[model samples]
Target: MVMRVVVIRVKILETNQQVELDVKSTTVRELLLRLGLTLSEHIVFKNGEVITEDDIVEDNSEVVVFTVKSGG
Candidate 1:
């Protein structure tokens, strides 16, 4: 029997925090939720490309998140 592990690197632009996670499969939304973040309040980028919350994050991938801000 063999087991597979997926590791993802995450970075939060606002907080300048970096984390590495070991997961089998996960979506951007799930990752955000795990990190105590809100979907509508942040944007996700996978390997320098923008990705939606529903998008599945790949193994050994880099995920970057930026907080959304609105000002008048």
Candidate 2:
């Protein structure tokens, strides 16, 4: 059996905290959930474009997740 490797880049907040995760999921939501990330108000961008939770990612794709902050 051959396994495909998917490289996903994750960026949290406004900082430069970047991390790479290897997964074999077809959708972004599946990858996030697998990485133990709970989707809330955080915005996710794939290759600079905003993507939904159901967005499917290809192999060696870069995914950036930013947490949006709101204040009173």
Candidate 3:
């Protein structure tokens, strides 16, 4: 099977960092892993909407990862 590559624009709210990544069109869980994400204290937004692990990361799409603090 052939894998599809797409450009992913990621914006990390806490660090004010913006990065562009070229990744496969797979599940969000895999994509996040590709980005070296290991924690679950953040939320992901795709196209200004909430996304889950089972969601597909579309080609040429933008994603935002917002870090949140809990149990204050």
Give the winner by lDDT: 1 or 3: 1
Give a tens-digit lDDT track for model 3, residues 1-72. Answer: 966556788898877988777764767777667767744867789989999878888768898987776547
lDDT of all predictions = 0.89, 0.72, 0.77
TM-score of 3: 0.74
- Candidate 2 differs from the real structure by a C-alpha RMSD in angstroms, to one decimal, of 3.0
Residue 62, candidate 1: Cα error in Å is 0.5
Query: Which one wins by lDDT: 2 or 3?
Result: 3
lDDT, candidate 3, equals: 0.77
- Which candidate leads in TM-score? 1
Error of 3 at 19 (Å): 1.3
Query: How close is every model to the real structure, measured as TM-score?
Result: 0.84, 0.67, 0.74
Write one digit per residue (lDDT tens) for candidate 2, span 1-72. Answer: 866555666776556677776764458677667656677756789878999988887667787877676753
State each model's C-alpha RMSD to the native.
Answer: 2.7, 3.0, 3.9
Cα lDDT over the full model 2: 0.72
Residue-level lDDT tens digits of model 1 in 1-72: 766555898999988999888886699989999999999999999868899999998788889999997743
